[model samples]
Target: MTVTNADRESLRHGKITERPLRDKPGYPSWAIKLVMAVTGLIFALFVIGHMAGNLKLYMPAHDGVAALDEYGAFLRTMGAPLFPYESILWVIRIVLLVALVAHIHGAITLISRSGKSRGKFRRTNLMGGMDSAATRSMIVTGVIILLFLLFHLADLTLGLSPAAPETFEHGAVHANMIATFSRWPVVLLYVIANLALFLHLFHGIKLAASDLGITGRRWRVVFSWLAALVPLIVVAGNIIMPLSVLFGWVS
Candidate 1:
């Protein structure tokens, strides 16, 4: 006596159930989810550290270089004598690039598989509808953030024309940020990107927690608060920078 999907659905009464995972010829859903969870955690840590470094721009400059500039220099020259200048920085960038690729690939694969299955594997709603919008719009927000990242790299890292400030100077982290944010349009772009990031991070942290099996009943409330709080603090730290520069506080 085989249990058909229809029989299972009737027994479940329209509720989504996690049927025994079929041996799909491609990547398994669980593996994809694990990749996303791990990579997302990596990104979360990176963003928090990056925001902290960005905040150093507010500290007073000495000898014509801002604290943020010194910080940037430190990153470039880290592990010197044993390692060449920028070797460690490049290694970090390569790791991030690999993680970014894995995270994006996992996201796209899950989205495709979910659409094909049509909620066949959806688990019980752990979030209890707290972030349905963010949950639904993860890929959309991810794409927006991806575009913003490319634009950001061009603006700051590459110092490209039009995207970068007219006064763009390599290694002049503080001055470059001020010059870029002095323009109203650049400030507006950062604000919009940060908004998208807020939603992405808010729901992503919760989902990652769920995927990683951190869903004990006793700690659900605490986890939810932390998921929201982390994104809020990150976004606040990021948004304050451009606004401060645009309003002449950082100059």
Candidate 2:
């Protein structure tokens, strides 16, 4: 093998070309974005369904209680014969849990990478105002929402809260809701948590839309409206329940 300048240059170029290929083999940026988008949308759908179901509290007490109970029962009995009691609900819960984990992981990874890339000396923009505020606070709001979700499950789903109904019957959802929200402190906590949820949801929707390649000059207005409206609707529906209870409107 003759050693020449040309051979040495070719070897150096080959090694340089292989460096990027060997840097890392992991999920690509687009894959991470897609995971975040898909998981976010799934979680959003569950929230919407939950809010809609909770709205049954507005039906007159006799009807509302029964209706809410029936709704609870229906969820448990879904896919009966084909699946055991509550099987469908468990499936949905599992799916949501997986999605939630994936979404959080993706968000954390992306946020960490972004922070490292931007460094600590990045300039601030006063003009960003609410938009910037919402974007920056996503992780904080998300954490609050997760904590609230755990508390909610303890209070309602598991009926393990000290404030839970005396009997804690399975299908007595309306009564349980009224029981929990009747207290001022619970109501206040719910209101604050829901505010965080609204903010998180609004920004999440917009970010997900952009991630899914649904952005451009033409789609900007539509995405903006949808991002705002979807979160508004979900939060409004959720907040009204506690407010109605607190105000004696839905007793």
Candidate 3:
């Protein structure tokens, strides 16, 4: 008796399984998903931390230095005398870049493989419209987030051209934020990007949970709420900052 691909799939109940790495020509789908899950979690944690740090924009300045500025300085000088100035920050940036590249590679590869595997027949749409839509929009939302990241880096971190306001000042995080968000267009851009971030985070969290094997009913329910709540908090925290700056509430 011969077992067909359908027989194997049925036996597996559509669950993703890993094959021995030695037998594969390239990284397997499960490995790609695991890479995406881990990298996505890294990004999710970083954004949450970043959003919390940005919230210091609301704190009162001490000795003429904004608390947000202090936070920014702390990030650069973290691991201080034990390490050279900005070394820790550079290390973090390098790690984040590597993760970003791996995550993107995994997404593109999985997408290509999925498309190729679907050759002549459409898979049964068991997950319904919302999940299906989110699955489809993954690439679009991912691209939006990617563009937003580059713009954010240029506008704030590097203080580079048109993205950065004329009032942009190095090491003046609070002031720079105020100056940047004071522009309606910039605020609008931030609003749109954060909205995209919200969608991306929401779907990505749930997907990552599934990828990581959270299939128990109770756990899935818990993750569903978490998937929504985490992104909501992060996006709300981030979106409010620019809005507050734009509205003259923070400055």
Candidate 4:
């Protein structure tokens, strides 16, 4: 077989190219960003709903407890007859759990990749100002929020924490909240955790928007305001409830 110069050139051109190590076959960076974005949005919605529900504590004592308790019952009975009691709530819980895992995994993967690519001495300060800090501290805040979530569940949902209310009631969410937040230490913990949550959500919303291609230059300012506003509202609302309980405003 005689090979011509043209044939050699064609063969050379047809050789498989190697991609960068980080771009190897697995979940691509875009896919990971998508997962992070979607899961973050889910969590954001949940936070908003949760904060709104918590604000029910501001109602008059008799009305507030009854309203909060009824709200709790409503969640459990969400799909009665067609579905078992608490089935919908459980389903939501499972979905949120999956999202949480995926979000964490994606975040860790991205951070590791970024750290390796940028090397140790790269200046992260060039990214932005406050937004950069929020972005950089995402993992820190995320871990804090995760720990706080476990404590929150133990303290309120399961009544398993040493700090849990002395008297546990099935549907009395208002009473439970008051009992928990009435303690100064618990109130302080909640405030700190919520501040972390605020930072996380602030960066998360902007990142999600950017990931989803919502970053038209004209719209950037709008998105930035929204990112800041939404988390502030949620955190403020949440902080108010605990502060109210601690100060006897809601008692």
Q: Which candidate comes out best when scored by lDDT?
A: 3
201 in model 2: Cα distance from truth in Å?
1.2
lDDT tens readout by residue for model 3, 116-153: 77877786766865567767677888999899899999
Candidate 4 lDDT over residue span 130-236, tens digit each? 88889778889999999999989988899985958787665778778878988999899899999999999999988888898886887878878889999999999
Better of 1 and 4 by TM-score: 4
- Give me candidate 2's TM-score against the actual structure: 0.85
The stretch of ten residues in a row with the least summed lDDT in candidate 3 is 16-25
lDDT of 2 by residue, 21-77 (tens): 233428776889899988988888889999998887776556434677778888999
**Least accurate 10 contiguous residues by lDDT in model 1:** 121-130
Residue-level lDDT tens digits of model 1 in 22-112: 6554677888898899999899899999999999988888897789999999999999979999999999999999999999988888777
TM-score for each prediction?
0.86, 0.85, 0.87, 0.87
Q: List runs of model 2 lying over 4 Å from the truth.
A: 1-22, 61-65, 163-167
By TM-score, is 2 or 4 better?
4
User: Model 1 segments beyond 4 Å from truth?
Assistant: 1-23, 119-130
Choose 2 or 3, whichever is better by TM-score: 3
TM-score of 3: 0.87
Q: How accurate is candidate 3 locally (lDDT)?
A: 0.88
Residue 57 alpha-carbon offset, candidate 3, angstroms = 0.7
Structure candidate 2, residue pairs in collision: none
* lDDT accuracy of residue 233 in candidate 3: 98
